[model samples]
Target: MSTAAKQKAKAAGIRLDDDSMDTPSEPLAPRTAPGQLIGLQGRVHSQQAEIEKLKRALEQRAPGKLPLEKLHEIPGRRRRLTSAEYAELKANLTAYPLAQPITVRERPDGEYDIVAGHNRAAVYRELGRTEIDGIVLDIDDSMVEYAAFFSNLLSPTLSDFEKFWGFKSLQESTGITKEELAKAAGISDSHVGRIMKFDLLPSESKDLLATCPERLGSNAAEQMAKAVAEGREDKVKAAIERLVSDNTFTQAQAVAATKADRAPRDRHEPMVIRRGARKVCQISARNGVVGVSFSGSAADEADQWAEKIRVFIEAELGKQ
Candidate 1:
């Protein structure tokens, strides 16, 4: 294989070394019959042939312009941009030339599959453009999905919910564990765990997030997941719905809404009544009762003030 092919394969986590291409000499199972052994060998040979085909296709090629109609969208390969973001992209493309060419790979059917830049291509089409500058990668079909994933993963605007689904899709595609994914993605395992909390969300919440992924973040998702585990799924779902509908609602407030009981009221400081730096009394309210404690000379006159207060209340009641 060429050095370029080796590099691409390595980036996709595929080993293209001679050792990996060699067929197994020993039977996969000692109890396997001759026919089964032949079948296994045939499968290995087929895989080797496919790898060689991919390597040959990886020969250097310059980027060229391709028609927009020829570029096709592959499901699960591209992240959907929000409507506002799409409009901004369209406006930018209209005012300025494309800064970067999209990447695509040619198919046997004489069409191209988009490996990245789905939004740019879409914007160009919306602008009534006929062709777009594209670099055709000669990678295998299996590697196309991974290419698209990594491309979208690096986007700064990708939301936490979108990232969670991306990680999930990559995991299901590669069958790798969370730890392995963390290492591969160059992120902490704990971060991966936190992102995966989206999986614990109810179907209704997931549906809402699919529409507005930026509504909730990883931290809020973790809190909601804990609430779900504690049998508060309904509250969590309601909170997420409110969050989606109300743009002003924050992730922290959404998590708070999932609590079974209302948050405790803030404590109020006592109000001190003083006479020229002398503490006369302190008035405070706690648990629905008001208390007044007199100090110094005020203690002796407390009964007099109490009688005045009683008389004032009686006069006010008589007016009412």
Candidate 2:
């Protein structure tokens, strides 16, 4: 150890062995390169200043009022509040003014973007107020999805469709697949997949589910989506019509009934056409289309029998 270091250590109550240090060496002084020492001192001062700034920030109050005109709404993966929900919020706020501050981030355009408390800001606007209390945060643009999601997590009135759309928006905006988002959002992967299927549904079916989101749970929606995927377009539309017409049936029952009604019927043997001991032809009908096939011998006589076949069909229609 240098002589000055030894002295300093000794002054600081550090013990050293004198006999081991008996070898002659240049005396060690508390020497540091001038520039390096200045740099280190500057670093220490900078760190202490940062610590003080953090302490002051922690002690600061919530941000003051932000003008409604200067606030820009956040887009992507956020649920729109229902009219009833809006009314309820307005009523509550009317009874009692806002106690909690909303959250926002300053934009480069000199406007603030809302991070949370959309409904509150909306209510304030409805009340003819020009400004509302909020806190400014340093949220990254990439984190907006999670931030919007968690902000609405505690809401009790959000519908299944709304949540689905929110998750979908997150998936699209963040470039994450539904499976990855499912884990992050604390939803089942299968459920996420099912919700995403809503986008694939025909517009008519989508509107039905959107209008009555509470009626159709994820399972029923998935079932309907599966039916759509299987090319049961007419059946899905019919099912949606039935659901709209009859409010008595639950979504599950409606889905079940639709599935049962659309199930492929068992193949029935074609009706045999016989004249006495001779089998003439076979008749079959599927999806309202009728077909008649002639035996090898009768095939040559099909043209001759066409007039008779028309007459027979007319007779059958008359009977019906």
CA lDDT, every prediction?
Answer: 0.75, 0.64
Judged by whole-model lDDT over C-alpha atoms, candidate 2 comes out at 0.64
What is candidate 2's CA lDDT for residue 134?
80
Candidate 1 clashing pairs, residues 3+ apart or interchain? none
TM-score to true structure, per model: 0.62, 0.47
lDDT of 1 by residue, 192-243 (tens): 9999999899977887887788888999999999999999999998999999
Q: lDDT tens digits, residues 1-320, model 2? A: 43223222323341111123566894553366986566545644443343233324323646688999888776532345657777988898889867666667789998988877788887898899998888776644534444554455446666666567566554443345566667655668887787776666567666665555555566677788788777776777777767766778677776775563557775876799988888889898877777888887899998878878899989999998
Candidate 1: stretches off by over 4 Å = 1-63, 75-78, 96-100, 139-141, 188-190, 229-231, 259-294, 297-320
Quote the lDDT for 21 in model 2: 58
Quantify how close model 2 is to the true structure by its C-alpha RMSD in Å: 20.3
- lDDT, residue 236, model 2: 70
lDDT of 1: 0.75
